[model samples]
Target: MARVKKKIRQEQLIEKVKNKPFLTDEELAKQLDVSVQTIRLDRLELGIPELRGRIRKMAENAQNKVKAIQSNEVVGELIDLELGHSGISLLKITEDMVFGKTQIAKGHFMFSQADSLAMAIVDAPMAVTGVANVKYKVPVHVGEKLIAKAEIVKVRGNKYFIWVKTHNETQEVFRAKFIVVSWGEK
Candidate 1:
């Protein structure tokens, strides 16, 4: 059997927190039992940027600062636009996007990308992810570009079922079904 070799530095760290909650550099370093500098180095090499403004945008868009308060630091941006039932977004995965030495790209990052796009399409004051059924089809690599395409598949009262697909350049990388709950002053 051939061992799968990691092709990027971020991949090493991403493997550490695939399905887990997001963590800060200090927190991740401590959890992995490594030095902060080591974690920083890994992040720098993997092109993972800081996620400082991410929560702010989500808060502003959601119109609910309290709900947008995020405890993690994986940053992604909305690089595409569409409205009503469908939209697209692009997120640049950085070193902070990983966990240890595996390049799976943290699941939350992908989830956020999809969720945010869904919110954008819904054009509601606030949107929340109620549930999600996601499947990882291929491993995402460092320096690889990711694109998320989302569409509302169904809607019931405050709940909406959205379908999202994430891709890297040429292949479909991740797919998810998101159940989002949006609220506003009706």
Candidate 2:
């Protein structure tokens, strides 16, 4: 990683954004060995929007085909959805989501995201997490974007077996197997 120097880093930042627009300011700062403020300044000078802006723009352009749950009820911004099959969502870790000292995000947030994604993919009026076998593969820090992908493995009566994996880019951070029950099912 090149230490981003004054004036020189702007060009590099532009290239970086072009290659990976999903990178947050904190991530860019880490890659360039600069402060987050410096990255933000460089991004601003380069005429690049923040990560949230990029995500929102992408989300708007990419239509969600099937929405089993209310959009607001989803744990993260639903990027794609195919009812009764699979779905994808993205969540950005923020200050409130992490521990004050550790800077590591709370496990519940990850679980909630995965669980909600799993429930949202089910073809039902209402879905609830019945039991979850969860695993945390890595410590997720604040400012990281977690992408949760959920797929239904099988359906046994009213219980749906779902698998969710949350990742930070290519690295797996969390995974869960959930047994979800639809309220419509008896």
Q: TM per model?
A: 0.56, 0.66
Off by over 4 Å in 1: 1-75
State residue 108's C-alpha deviation in candidate 1, in Å.
2.4
lDDT of 2 at 126: 75
Query: Cα lDDT of model 1 overall?
Result: 0.64
Q: For model 2, what is the C-alpha lDDT against the true structure?
A: 0.83
CA RMSD, predictions in order: 15.1, 8.0
The residue-by-residue lDDT of candidate 1 on 81-179, one tens digit each, is 334456556687777786576866787777777666666666455677788888888877667778787888888988878898999878998899988
Q: Considering summed lDDT, which 10 consecutive residues are worst modelled in model 2?
A: 60-69
Off by over 4 Å in 2: 1-68
How far residue 130's Cα lies from its native spot in candidate 2, in Å, is 0.6
